[model samples]
Target: MRHLTLLGGLVLGLAVAGGAQPMTAAPATTPLSAIAALRDPAGQVIGTATFRQMGQGVQVSVEARGLPPGGHGMHVHEYGRCTPGVDPATNTVVPFGGAGGHFDPGMSRNHDDPQAPNKYGHGGDLPMLNVGADGVGRATFTSDKVSLTGMNGVLNRSLVIHANPDDYKSDPSGMSGARLRCGIISRNGLTTRDYPLPGAQDFPEGVAYDARKGVIYTGSAVNGTIYAVDAASGAVSKFQEGGALGRRAALGLKVDPQGRLWIAGGAQGTVSILSPDGVTLKVLQTPDSPNPYINDLTLAPDGNVYVTDSTRPVIFRVDPDLTLTRWLDLGDTPVKYGPGINLNGIAATPDGRYLLAIQLNTGELWRIDLRSKAVQRVMGGLERGDGLLLDGRTLYVSRNAMQVVSKVSLSADYGSGQVVAEEPLRGLRFPATLAAVGGDLVVTQSQLDKLQGGTPETPFRLTRFRKF
Candidate 1:
């Protein structure tokens, strides 16, 4: 069978039949855990193993069937490949020889006991795996020498099962015989910390960060209550009362350079601008007769605010002087608005000459030229895209229904892009938006999918994904 290797961080599987997938530098991971599926020479998956972080050590569990009924050796190999190759020492072909030798990040070159320290033994050394009469073997243990992340991490490594038992004292491989099965290790998810909100059913939707005061701002989808969280302590406080100034629901939020909050009034067809002191400075609205659902907004470099209406095929713009106007209408262009939720998230290019928005139903990205009033569909699919954040030429799309964050690298003109990575971050439950604060990604767990006559998780929280 064909084999595909898994790389840690931003890089995932290798090239498949169609074409090569885009890859980039690895992202920072902490206390990472992994799992592997053991495959025999015939490409048949026979077993599995799991690795987890527990305190300062790593816990390992392995279970396999259809093996010899005796003691066998198991080790974390140096490489992540499971294909056959020529053995350097034997000058002959070896089963699963591509995995290389035992993992020895410290370069100790010793295959001592697992209980020994890293300086004295290889980090991959473990106790012998004993098989029963039913050809089933299982082992569970903890090791302090190896880690799941960092320099000594094994996320992109390989696990191998040897034919003979380990002697615990022999050099190189403890007199273990030929390798029988090998599996490539892959990461499960990034570690996360939760910052809970106050109400049991707040259903927080949007997130924004104020660097000056080191605070995070989020709003409630249920009643438009805006809450501020201290970046250093995760302390939650009310920033604005719910449903103030005829605003029924709050969705997307952005903190301007002047520290004023630009709030989107969902389904109210209005946009409210509030000062840092929680006082409403101004409110803008669209025509109430046709009805509109203002879902998200973005701040441009020229100090203009662009908003997206989910129900209507139109975009509204608010000038720096607080003057609101109908910026662009998709009905007048080639872009078609589907039946369900249309445009959800809005973001502008750094040059302020173009704006990019996502259509949830069609999963299409549209680019609008501010200078020419021209609109064109960007080349990429981001279905279920809820929030959009642009950092230089890279765009981050939060897919709420898929429970994944897609990293897209845009071209120079912002007309085309490709998904470089899609990470399913841990502790995210129906994530609605994303905010970069102090090198960490703050994501809101809106839980909106379960809001149909069902009880939401108590004390809904925002998660901090530690990504550098």
Candidate 2:
């Protein structure tokens, strides 16, 4: 019998060719690394995985198609070949000769087992692949320990599917049954149809929620594309594609009390206000700056719009007359990147007496006293803080680094804070923005890479989380 090894403890056997059937060639000779696709004989893509470098670790996204509805186990295996059947007489199916054996570059063993814990196995063991009724499974995730540069490079190994779901801690096979499918990671980019639309190539630095219009607007970093998503149905539409603003890539989006959408074009140092109907109303140029790279903005209760320059660590107050005033200079915040303070997500208290800004690079959450302009760190060590929502005395923060959401109770002083909720929402992939409607939390899963079953590569996804 021919066998294949994969990430975790999965093993697969390929059926030998018989009669008119062609022999399953020794898994292709492609270099097993990078992002690649697995396709069926008919040239239909079955799945895809992308390997990325994050910090000192590796992040991979697997999306699959043409599977039974619901969840299925997925993992990287020890070997790359999938041979058919087994020799019952020996009671051993190829004995690791085919797939190899759990990828143990470190010679570690077992899953979450205290004996080995972090030592054994490669970073490819995954939970079941959840497919919708339409038989599509999509997911994005990261691993801090593995690399996908090449076979010996980390993913150069093999990938396999199991008959049963992985318990995540089982040794050998995790008690999961026979192997169902197998593939090898090749150096050349995997072939795949764009599943989910890739997120704006540049960072989606700022997001805004317009409750009355029930729409969300976000700015991209690369090309000038302003995304308008319907709050009711999560339908996304593009407005203003190829203009000066389009070329500049919008950054932050805010809604004025008068119900107009204001966008900061980071590339051009310009601000464009859009009507409720998604039409441009006016454009204002930022004064005293070249290439402002506007980061975050919020409308104050005092009827003025406050904008932050990500490149210079400065905040400007813009009046209705387009007059600009230097509100605060945050250059001394003990964190560098000056203008690029990596200052991204921003929000304000209902009373507008306090504003919250998240420093993405430093993972610091700062509360600014509007009156004194004093900035205090309310919390720090949050990963890739991207979105913020304030409801009553509670604050909701999205941590893209850890791929989770957290809720904290806010004190009048913005000091005594307590964590209220922190849980993973299933099927959430790279959540970048959030909106709350009538107690329900709406989140956007910008599936940023190809996974087992994501569509259009990195398509946008919406999920609802109910708060009790």
Candidate 3:
């Protein structure tokens, strides 16, 4: 990953070179001493941040009193909970680890280079907070893209301190370690912001549903346990567990028309087929010829399964005999490496005539005619296109970079495309998969590995959207 200095001088140069108006740095108004104190669950004033309105942005100076001596990743997460005390059994902190991912206003892209020309991370990642041997560290930075006033006007979110530094572009969540400390970010003399969803709902991370049976199947990427959820009541039941699959990290779930549930085991690079009753489990390994970082899978109308490999940039077609064949190799696409193309999600049209795949590294969505094996660009200029689903005449695509979902209409020529809908997802973070259940759109937020730092409240979210 490339690291560009986000300094005031660079901001001016880029603005001028790009023929844009230069941004003026706003003067600090609120006194640093006037800022109110923020405390953790133990009632300790861990840090204090002074907020000032800037030119179309906000500058926040943060100072911590008793932080560990070193540099730490800091961010204003979406939620405000600061539950303390680690769990003795698991050595994990409680609700503190459950503060869902960053605050993604657009719901399109992932947490990467926010300065990228095309797609970037949201306005949550702040400058690295450093602590000295005296256990106090102070840093001042400006967010020209976002402000505390726009953060729901509450300015009462939590400032999460990560165990490790952030690489920034690691999707789902930054590779940063656990949440060491959390403090509620509040305005001077203002009350704390009220977070609507306190503790997250512990639903399945990646789920695929059977619209007919109203049954939802989910799997853990860490434990590899398959769970069955009653779609109507949201009751969870463990269907399958440890056998020969090692630690089953179920990435994608789909049910064939014949009532077979297909599970994409990401860790093992294999597919597990379960009977309609969710009793029997069958495993199929990837052929030796291809890279097997199985990310997403979908069943074609012909009863064969199409799976995507994130690392190899190829789509594999699996037959009943467990024979794997190359369905499409997308290495030839013109994609920029940084914001260009890395295959992540795969979906096919209802008739199985067209197949769509999302490039994670870029916002490019490719449409492939299964019959001709010809690929065409459908949509571009997205933040990070992750999950894709086709419903009726509209195609629903999840942009992990922008933190929003966009809909594109298919043209008669099959090559041209038009935007139908693009709406900001109010409370979604790194949504990884999209599915259609009985004409309704269902989405899952993988939350990736963000749970390690925060608590395991409800990292996996299942949301239903009605098409207008």
What Cα-based lDDT does every candidate model obtain?
0.78, 0.57, 0.59
Q: Score every model by TM-score.
A: 0.64, 0.58, 0.60
**Candidate 2 residues 255-338, lDDT tens each?**
777778787676577778888777787777676666566755777777778876767677777788767677788877644563
Highest lDDT: give the candidate number. Answer: 1
Model 1 CA lDDT for position 266: 84
Candidate order, TM-score descending: 1, 3, 2
The CA lDDT at 49 in model 2 is 70
Better of 1 and 2 by TM-score: 1
Model 2 ranges off by over 4 Å: 1-122, 125-159, 162-206, 242-247, 287-291, 332-341, 447-456
Q: List the residue pairs that clash in candidate 1.
A: none
Q: Model 3 off-target regions past 4 Å?
A: 1-78, 82-205, 242-244, 289-291, 320-322, 331-341, 449-459
**RMSD per prediction, one decimal?**
16.4, 15.7, 12.4
How much does candidate 1 score in TM-score? 0.64
Q: Model 1, range 73-110, lDDT digits (tens) per residue?
A: 88888777898976766878888987878887556778
